[model samples]
Target: MRITSKVLITLLIVVAITACFSLITHLSNESQPVGDEIPARILISQTPLSTPLFVAKKLGLFKLHGIDITLIPCNGGVECMSMMTHGKAQYATISESVAMFNSFRDTDFSIISTFVTSDDDLKLLALPRRGFTSIRDLKGKSIGVIKSSASEFYLDSLLLASGMKPTDIERVYLKPDKLIQMMKIGKVDAISSWEPWGYRAQATMDVVNLGFQGMYTLSFNLATMNRKDETSHERSKRILAALQQAITWIQDHPEKAKAIVSDTLNIENNQLDWMWRDYVFRLSMTNVLLANLQLQARWALEHNLVEGKQPDLRSILDRSALQAMQDEVVGQ
Candidate 1:
């Protein structure tokens, strides 16, 4: 075919437009960022038990996983859930059973992973003035707890094992630090608390020993998230990955972990050592943990903390990401 000047001009213009469009597309693609810097806000309670998370964050583990983690410190797990409900944080490290039972009682709040499993670190503290030697002697007396917090379950379990029902004692709800003050003022007979508070009560109040739930049952420690849309799924996985690495690093480096915890939580070196020795920092979601969680769920039901309905354990916990991590390590 013979090409006319008009046809040649038109072809040239079309080709120019196509080239320009391609260039624009390429420029646009180049302008957009490639790195994903999704910020992960984590809710933590101020205590030795929850200090490792802060240690991990401060040490840049979360950043290693491509997450910008913001640690939101709260009083306890119950307050942490409030932060989760109000969209204050993406993920939270709290008591697995406490969060689950509360969710069962109210909304269906679910936790993703169980980081710290053992509850052997918890202490049943009695003020020196109370003259309480054991759980039996503490019957019919007031016991301070965080109300719907993890310590509440600990208190309940302690009472149950001691042949005392919940109705046998007057339950008092107070913050960790306040519990120590209340006990000092003779407001309550005993208090069930974790780490620093128990440690403080022993030091400040010179409290008498009741008993400890040592290696008793694996209570949920951290890695709890609300059941949201898929928008947070990948983010959740990444956050867990960071946390898993942090826990593993702590396990591998106990001296470093102890120093970090002591500095972060403002506890003495010996106290930090006690916490490290008492609690297992293993982040595995093992069968033993699952069994204990189920038992906790059942206990919630029995104690009317879950009402008539029970939380579907499978739906509440997503262990795929955790399982994958385990598999990857084992495969390596």
Candidate 2:
């Protein structure tokens, strides 16, 4: 009886200790703040326009906001949006024009915020050898552009501003890299593209800037699918918070931010300096974005770029995440 009692007492004590240990562990876990465990894959184009995103990743701001981000680099926003659409990524850093173009077909994604804007990002570069020294020189000339992209829109806008129409020029639809190569070989007289392609073309070839400016403002925006779930909304808010931090950091530390961009993009300091002047990095949903979308939609309709009625431009914006951050969603 004595031995049995001793054994029972040992078993009881073991059970009590195990229970106490488990309880302690459970309580400890409950007390600890959640770390950076929220995984997000953001498709980013390799361009200076994505400076804030580059800053966020370089400075680990995303993790600080409880987001584990994997930035997948692509050639441009067009490809980034395509990858996001195919579910290869959960988010994309795309130009608003790309979103506008896609809105005509499927309003599957919603623009979360416009993180950066620039009036001079897009330019008309002409090969002087091709007798293309001005915007008027583009008439009846072969111009390389990424069809259905901001490149095309910029080209058309420049043409309209020059009192010309799209029908007057031969648009050689090509990817950005191909456009550069085609221009070098004299296949295209001019290329309507955004930086750093324009910067790149100038570096590699003798090209003349057509001096087109202020025809359109390009905005780099964060876009994701229209997910209405609370969890998704929370995740988006976290992302916006991180990006907002990055934007603040960039503004406060311009030189450091420029260095980060220069190193990450492998762009020369002079090149960075050249393009950095035009970038206005911030988080906002202003009348500027709205007006641009409406104009693009009308242009798309007029040009038969997309079939059917115009997409309600306002519907494609999901400002819940921005609103959560008290972001500057102006004129909405």
Candidate 3:
């Protein structure tokens, strides 16, 4: 009887141990995406403002987070957002205004985290040779702006604040880089844009800021396709964590960050020096952000930039990934 009881006890213990092992295996598989098996492709805007992600990639922070990422470099956030919107990429860094405009289509993308913020980033660069010194002076004069991007919204705000209607000036829709050329040749009297294009205008035509987006900050955010799966949630957290970690590295090592950006973007260190301090990189989402997005959407709607209904500002924000980051930091 004692021998039989021992054999039965050993069998029960073995079965319990096998079940525990199986449970752990299942969890390990479900908790995170198999990085070796599947890689996440993200779209990165090839701008100095995207220095953190670049630093992260250079330092292998993404890999440290167990994520395999393939970055597709784009000229601007709008371009980045376009690729992500079409499912060509899983993630993107898009400007707040561009993201707001794209949200009208209800794409798979959602704003997961804000990358950078600046009060005087977006400015109306007026050619000094044309006697355009102030925002109000640009009235009734031709103003070159990039349509359907932040440039468009910023121009509208400037016009509104000056109590001038859009029709009061010749709204010459042009690409940001082209705006500088247009001003140089006297095609437009003023141009509303964001750097480094704004800086380009200043250098070439000696353009001075007639106005700044002080009240409406020029912000950039990181976004990804919205997915409800646990694996997706974990992956998003991992990406943010990697980026957050990189931001610390950037703040700690500005010269190293600048060198990486200069090599990657082909920007001269001298050129970067002027606009470097304008940017503040961080991961944040606040009520002010929400209000800015909503206001931007309304501006797009009123300006006929988009048709039909507006998107829910709250719906576009998925902070679970950010919350996960907070938990991890506190845990550490």
Candidate 4:
């Protein structure tokens, strides 16, 4: 039968619409954004700080599950965060303390999951001029810090323990790496920083160590996002699961774990090992940590860090995904 021009046009239009629908369905079904198929680009700091996540990616854990992670070199956590905030990247690793402090202050971000934290990681180093051995000696002395960041809060906690307020001592804001040089030149009386800086000072300058661990009650390096809801939650779960696997491997095969980290960070095996021991990963969150976070929120509220209203503590944390992953990990 000969088809009319009108029918031919209508049939063509129907075919085009059907084809478009089919293509969209196929793409949606096949494009797994969670697991390893994530399209979100990730940026990490240049330092060895993000070694575990790097190890997970290098080991094919991310790819095996379909995660497409783009690792960009950044100067530090704050820099990585800037990349995320500016839309240069989707996610970045940062200390939970930083996120909490910022969130308290109504900063624009949400916590995805936690990374590594330990009691042995932070140290307070004294300059040669001050000859400070205890937190008390830090009184009236200028201490270098990564101000308004997690590092600052860690130092504040240390000071508070010593009966000193933030106003009691002058804090000089500097990058972690520059503190040592500043100390050598008498630019600052002391420095509070994490390893490499902590270890570097001990090895190079014999910087007196005051009794303080970078350890906080709830230390977490979270995967952050500006978006919230099911999709982000699912992605966060996959990332946390991958992190948990990496942590488990680190615990079971300490030497091999060191090698993985060393390779990822491009650090010497010995240095990696030293750094490895300093980190503790329990892969568990607790009420105590929640309480601490609430305390942090309260502090921010009291100090006007957050907006006029405070956020719900329970709503801020989505630990259900982590719990499910933990169950699976434990089962295996």
Q: What's the residue-level lDDT of 39 in candidate 1? A: 71
Estimate, for each residue in 1-332, the C-alpha lDDT of model 4 and write its tens digit: 99999999999999999999999988775333443366557777755567667777767656644556677877667667767877888777766556665564445565555566667667777854456668887778898888556667678778778888878888899986688899888888888777667767777766677755544643556556557576666666677777776777667877887776666666677666666666766565567556767777776666454576666655556566677677765774
**CA lDDT of every candidate:** 0.71, 0.86, 0.81, 0.68
Per-prediction TM-score to the true structure, in the order listed: 0.81, 0.87, 0.85, 0.77
Where is model 2 more than 4 Å wrong at Cα?
A: 1-36, 327-332
Q: Roughly what TM-score does model 3 have, to 2 decimal places?
A: 0.85
Model 4: lDDT of residue 36: 36
Put the candidates in TM-score order, highest first.
2, 3, 1, 4
Taking the tens digit of each residue's C-alpha lDDT, what string does model 1 give over 184-206? 88898888777677667776657
RMSD (CA, Å), each prediction: 11.9, 11.0, 9.1, 12.8
Segments in model 1 whose C-alpha atoms lie over 4 Å from true places: 1-34, 106-108, 221-231, 326-332
Where does candidate 4 clash, by residue pair? 36-65, 36-66, 36-67, 37-66, 37-67, 96-220, 104-306, 105-305, 122-214
lDDT measured at residue 232 in model 3 versus the true structure, 0 to 100:
82
How far in Å is the alpha carbon of 128 misplaced in model 1? 4.0
Clashes of 2: 0
| Candidate number with greatest TM-score | 2
- Superposed by TM-score, candidate 1 places the C-alpha of residue 229 at a distance from the truth, in angstroms, of 5.8
**Candidate 4 overall lDDT versus native:** 0.68
